[model samples]
Target: MDRKILIYPRGNGEGKGNSMSMFLCLDETTLPPDTKLFVKFLLRVISQTPTKSDDFEFKVENHFGPSCLNWGAQKFMSIVKLNDPKKGYLVGDTCIAEANVTLIGEVTTAS
Candidate 1:
């Protein structure tokens, strides 16, 4: 299955504060049947310009549990704290963020 990764800004509905996060997910239709596996991945994000960065390392197992029709998305790096000025999360009066994702491996059931 093909996986897509991306980054975006999130804010409370009340307009309290905004934060950055990453989403790693795959298409459920392509999941191998009657099998369970562990997905190891890394998500990295950096300023589109030149500035700070962030990353997450973890594994997603039981992604195809019965409760979910689709494998669904795995969200990470929420509530990221961004410092203004030096960090330059926003520069040139523009906000730019880039995301990169690497799928390390998928350990499937032996039987």
Candidate 2:
């Protein structure tokens, strides 16, 4: 299967903080006709501050195809502090996120 990585900047609370959203896009065209794909993954995020790593990990599974998968609203973590500079999450600070995906199996349906 083909994979695509995507990232975007997201703001919260009128300068209270900033966050990054990461997504994985899988190309559906690569799958065989009438086949369904299932995928699962664990996501991790790391910030500049050693102890400030994201407090959560994500695990998800869904039908694989030309769709974008990412963390939901309750899972998104603030990676930057735009309103405060002393917090170490400065404007130019960088955060790293990763996703480990596993393909459980593929099934073909009868029409």
Candidate 3:
């Protein structure tokens, strides 16, 4: 099934906050079946500069399990994927977050 990705972040100086909005694109088939993975994909794409590595990067955190200990932010940085380089979504959550968010064709990754 195709999923609509959604993310909300609060930070930075207004006029440019949206520039830092994170984006994630998963190759659909990578996600496991019958299982809901609560993950946050943080992406920092350099639109105008055209650089290889970002000056900053967004973080995707997934929460799962009873204690939700497995889905901490520590695992996020290592798992997030950028569209330009196109690494695809990386899943490593042993726990699910309280957020059961569905992606809705975001402005960031839709390009």
Candidate 4:
């Protein structure tokens, strides 16, 4: 499966200015026309601190297709919490984001 991770540091849509937005996006161009995918995915922001890692994570299952290529949380994590040093999400001005996706099934129209 061809997939990509999308993150908005300043957030997106509803999350803008309040939290970070993260999403799993299916590459529609790589898929056959009228194809749909059922997928389970996990998205995380890894803490960079050496002492402890308080990761922020979200998981969900959804369908993706040409019309719906993306699915994820609008409020993945609060901006204040992510930027706080105590949270350990950002260290030395760097933060790590991860995505794990599993393809549960696929369907395609017989055209």
Candidate 5:
């Protein structure tokens, strides 16, 4: 299965202008009709600091299908926190993001 991580630097929808938004998206076009995938995933904004303790992260478990191809947090992290130099989320005009996905199961409907 193929997946993608979407990041809204200025946020998206409700989080716009206030926070960062992140989403995990399943490529529904690659899947057969009526197929659902159960997945567990972690999304993170890695810290550049040596300690790495200030990394911002979130975890989600969900079923992805054609009807709902994406899922995630609209208010992932406050822009203030992400922009704060002490937080180490951004360094040298670059931001590092990571995603880990594990497929738990698959469901196919009989039609």
Candidate 6:
């Protein structure tokens, strides 16, 4: 399956979930350490098929737009694993879609 690395929230508060609601997210830095719950991590495309060693992760990024209070971008943690859309691309229906990421993660643990 075609896949990418996805960054998301660790919990439900501060804006996080299927809603894609505006939320404050952290920049490349400022992410907390020693996080046992969830943290952001970027990795290369791992596969085109499912594998046994596929490990995925997401971090809480500050919210965006007016609803999220335009926190600009901060950081949080992730609590879910999103799958590819059966009929749409990742983070679709946006002006700057190519630059926007709906979700991301390794695919099949390709080596």
State model 1's lDDT. Answer: 0.44
lDDT of 5 at 48: 94
Error of 1 at 68 (Å): 6.4
Query: On residues 9-108, what C-alpha lDDT tens digit does candidate 5 reach at each position?
Result: 8899999999999999888779888899999999999999889898899998999998999999999999998899988998878889989999999999
True-vs-predicted CA distance for residue 87, candidate 5, Å = 0.8
Arrange candidates by lDDT, descending: 5, 4, 2, 1, 3, 6
lDDT of candidate model 2 versus the reference: 0.54
Local error of candidate 3 at residue 10 (angstroms): 11
After aligning candidate 6 to the native by TM-score, how far in Å is the CA of 106 from where it should be?
44
Each model's C-alpha lDDT? 0.44, 0.54, 0.32, 0.88, 0.91, 0.27
TM-score of 5: 0.94
| lDDT tens digits by residue: candidate 4, 1-109 | 6888898988999999999899998887898888898888999999877755588899999999889989998899999998899888977778889998888999998
The best candidate by TM-score is 5
Best by lDDT: 5
TM-score for each predicted model, relative to the true structure: 0.48, 0.58, 0.25, 0.92, 0.94, 0.17
**Tens digits of per-residue lDDT for model 6, 1-111:** 122223332323454453222232334322223211122223221222334143322234332221222232222222222234321222232111111333333222223
Model 6 spans with C-alpha error above 4 angstroms: 1-84, 91-111
Clash pairs, candidate 4, are: none
| Cα-based lDDT at residue 106, candidate 5 | 93
Which runs in model 3 stand beyond 4 Å of their true positions?
Answer: 4-35, 38-40, 53-55, 63-111
Candidate 4 stretches greater than 4 Å from native: none
- The total number of steric clashes, by the backbone 3 Å criterion, in model 1 comes to 0
Per-residue lDDT, model 6, residue 101, is 35
